[model samples]
Target: MKKEIKKIVSYSSFLALILMSVLACSSSEDSSSEEADSDDGEEAVTELHAAFAAFNSDAVTAILSDDGTEVYIETTGYPDHTSVYWETDNALYIDEPDVSKTTQDTYIGGGQGEAASFTVDATPDLTGATVATQLNTIGIAVSGASIFNDQEGAGDLDQAAGSLDWAGAHKGPGVYHYHLEPTPITSDDDSLVGILLDGVFIYGRQCNYTGGTPTDLDASGGHTSVTQYTDGVEEYHYHIINEVYAAGNYAYQPAYVLFAGPFQGY
Candidate 1:
């Protein structure tokens, strides 16, 4: 069932085109875009971005909106990988003794069962000014977990680094989320991490375009170039900056901040 859904989503361009056509005939100017609530100068997409295929098929389902101007990503928010946060009875659980569990009783799926849905513009408004990311899930990782900013509570992430597992993620009172580079998904090399709330894909430290650390990144660790998924055409995307975060007694020392953003794609 999961494989079938993934196949449909990964190759639903034809279906998306039909939907777009229908929308075009009925309402031409009412597609959502960069201005979340506005439809002016909106661009309709023909399909879901190919990068979405990198997400965990078992836990995530990405679909094009009826108007074809937005992508809806729904996830179980349960990672397919082994983690200290998983309940010991669950198959993916692992004992990371070095990691400090958030609470002896707190575990993934212990609360409301970490499920979330997000709707983002198919085409990000790059021409608009940058927008800052707020607290909570800023994006979803390919591992089917939430991607958070370098923050824990109202304070900096330094205070909670010890709680993070090998994946640089931990379960707070809410969902299990990553605060630093999720090495299980991407390390020093260039790999598709996930898509951000601003509708831009974020990659690992090294870029496939240059085969090394990008030299021309904006303040948000984003640049325009050909990623492994872009075929030959250059596209705008974000990368995990190569700089080490050097925070508290983190299990992984010299960790890279996943994303600290004033989103350029919004």
Candidate 2:
């Protein structure tokens, strides 16, 4: 009887050990699941904060028009040569210089032209209703080389243009998009130089619209060919002027449309 009781006790001990092992594995799995959930929640919160910060900052401002059309101006280089307006249709319009003037002196050099007068409604219309509404239809364009030209250590303009990061954040959340000289557009030059926009950077030159089929415009200007992007969307982003005036140099005409998001005004 004594031997039999001992054997029974030993079996009970083995059963208890097995149960304890199973419980330990279950606890470990639950802990791992909880940790993953916590990490996902934190990431979501970070993204929300970044978006909200951009919305509330002064980098973007509303310019309500009398005709029920809303206009928002990014004053990065406001009133200066680089000043531009983002309309509801996502079209970016540069203030044309007056045409009466025979010689317009620009930072680069003197060019024969006239400054276009400011009108309520003009060609290349930039008026829009909301930020996201415009962005959804129209894209974005960037003009101006003041920042790129003034940058230090900028190599050849063409090479710099190719390396620009269009989504880089700038002061007041403005993105850099033109004049890729002085540094690669995707590099931290803008941020290091005290020009950051929510940690996002902009493209140096205007990204050409490649949504449609590729087209070739004869050598009237030069070797011109329009290639579409991977998705085959239809929109003209910029013009690549290669071999202009037989100089063998290349220059890009930057233009874009703003479509959507909190960039809209009241």
Top candidate (TM-score): 1
Clashing pairs in 1: none
Model 1 segments more than 4 A misplaced: 1-39
Tens-digit per-residue lDDT, 1-266, candidate 2: 99999999999999999999989988988998898876533221111211112221322332433443222323233211222222223333333322111112231111311111111111112123322211110212222221322121333333322222232111112323333222322221111111111111122222334222224422211112232221443321222222211212222223121111222211
- Name the lDDT of candidate 2: 0.26
Alpha-carbon RMSD, each predicted model: 16.1, 18.6
User: Across residues 168-250, which tens digit of lDDT does each residue of candidate 1 receive?
Assistant: 99997799999899989988999999989999999999999889999999999999999888788899999999998987699
lDDT of 1: 0.89
Off by over 4 Å in 2: 28-42, 50-266
Query: Residue 206 in model 1: shift from native, Å?
Result: 0.6
Q: Model 2 — TM-score against the truth?
A: 0.26
Predicted structure with the largest lDDT when compared to the true one: 1
